[model samples]
Target: MLRNGQILFLCALALLTLGVLMVTSAGMQIDQASAEQPILVDGGLSPIAIMSGRTGMYAALAIGVMGAMAFVPQRLVERAIKPRPGRFYLMLGVGAAALLGLLLLVYLPGIAREKNFSSRWIEIPAPVFGTLSIQPSEIVKWSMLGLLAWCAVSAGDRLRLFWRGLVPMLIVLGLVCAVIMKEDLGTAVLIGAVGVIVLLAAGAKVWHIGVLAPAATPKPVVDRLNAAINKLLALPDVKTKLDRIGVVPMPETPAEFNKRIQE
Candidate 1:
């Protein structure tokens, strides 16, 4: 039987596999077209060549991330935040400062243009490395988790009082939400959900958990709606099953109807 941690790991692995498969499927046509083309170009290969290189780079990043996570000692993480009262406050302050720095970096002159109206990533120019990109929201999510966990553990006896324990958490959560909303609403929702989960695990009240639970589900629908709206806004041909909606002389097969619609 797998332990709880092992089960969670397997589930994450499965999800990662599914995501990669989806990406591959989406790129399949382009990948095939590229593969059929000549190998060399003036300075570099075609756009397909660049994409093939990126695919390998992405795979390497995934492997490196997993390897780092697997080898890193849990004790080192724990020690970094060392269960001390003042240190927790210090860490929270540091996290806040780092978040602020990211925000400023995203808005700065040259960097702001690179963001394309979405201030979620920072492009750093490096001499030898060309350019490096960082996502501030990802850092903020992890930081919020650690900070909330610290708050929960510290609140201990004080957790009995709703005001003392809950207030601090709410304040931190609001700050994080505000920052993330400026850049990416989707990331904000995800960070908020994770923060709430960490709070619940830290022994937050049942009512609090109930209040936060519903916030997680609607965002997925909102995201889908936004994507649809964007597609429509772009003035692309709107293709939908609705075009065939009950408009057959004799009832046509579903597959046949779909093929006909495409035609």
Candidate 2:
């Protein structure tokens, strides 16, 4: 019988294979303006050429990475990551600071790049790869998780104390979320949700979790929200449901939504 890890590995491999096939067939469709640029491919420049080549390379690299991580012994992995005797807080502070600094680079001109109107990747030039970009938000997601785990482990017996254990961890988590929220609000929310799960697993008080309620959406963000009636009216499939409800949809800010819910 295939082990659980082996089954997961096979599933991942199948998904990656499907991705490679899609890239190979669909190819990227860049605009004529960008196509004129020479950065895409070294000798030959075309949509299919660039995507097929890069995607193939990335798939190979990903498979190798997965293999390496899967084979590492659990005990050695724990020892490498586990906090040292005296430097738990120091390690968390330094590591989070370094990651935050890296994440901030996504805003720098020439170094930062955008995709789908989101500025969240840093560009790097490599001899073999030509041009490569790294998503600092992806790193921030996992690093925040690691920081939460470290906080939980370090807190240990003092986890019940409000000031001694919980407050400090909450501050760090908030800081990480705030930084990530600048470029990727969706991802920051996901990180916060996962952090809550980690905290609860670590035996944090339920009331303490309740204290971290979701904040109201910003005014600028509220202004950007489309009217609910417009959206509902546009959906042909739900028109009957809306008619039967006999309720009118109106534009409302997030604060208004909260107020109505409370009422």
Candidate 3:
């Protein structure tokens, strides 16, 4: 029997694979800059011009990490809820802090890479990738759940308290969202939603989570789009028409929807 977590991983991997294949199959074209220069075509694959190589490399890296995590022991994962002796700067104790530091580096002039008016990536030159761009927010997003879990478990019964238990986690969530929002509002909203949900499941008070609720964070255009699509798919006629065309209706969470958009 597949566990819920396993099912979720499978779904995510399926989406990633679909994106990789779609990108790899994109038709290649001649180098437009060199189009005026002499060109030779020897029946080689010319249509893979886009970001096929780079996309595949990153996709493979993601899949590899996921595969590794799958085999990790559950006890080890649970043990990670608490930090190790004397070394309090690891995943459990300071994971969020470490990620926060890395994220702040995005504002450090020369190293920061900007695109579309956002400074969310740090560019590092690498062998095959030419210039490898690392988004610290992506790392933080993946680690936040475990960090929140640690926070909740650490808080224990204190979680029932208003200021003591949840506020610290809320601060972490706020800092991350605020930093990411300066560049990527969509992701900031997504992280906020996930953080609140995780804390709620961990026994946080409804009103406690609601403390940060007033924020629409300027706007999360992707989540809004996803919600609208779901409302449309809820209608019987829309569902029937899609079925006739062999279009299966799959509602994605904000995270997954954001990924599809990024791809």
lDDT of each: 0.58, 0.70, 0.69
Candidate 1: tens digits of C-alpha lDDT, residues 32-142 = 336567433223434454435444456546756875777779899778656565454555566666665666666677655444667677777766445667786777777
**Candidates by TM-score, descending order:** 2, 3, 1
Summarize candidate 3's per-residue lDDT along 136-232 as a digit string, tens digits. Answer: 8898887777787776766666777866666767877888778887887666656676777788888986645432223364347655766775785
Ten-residue stretch with the least lDDT total in model 3: 42-51
C-alpha-based local distance difference test score of model 2:
0.70
RMSD of 2: 9.6
Give per-residue lDDT, candidate 3, residue 170.
Answer: 81
**Best candidate according to TM-score:** 2
Ranking by lDDT: 2, 3, 1
Q: Higher TM-score: candidate 2 or 3?
A: 2
Superior candidate under lDDT, 1 versus 2: 2
Tens digits of per-residue lDDT for model 2 on 55-138?
877888899999999989999988887756367577767877887788889998888998898889999998867799899889
**lDDT accuracy of residue 202 in candidate 1:** 73
Model 1, position 201, has a per-residue lDDT of: 66
* Top-lDDT structure, candidate number: 2
Clashing pairs for predicted structure model 1, backbone only: none
TM-score of each: 0.54, 0.64, 0.59
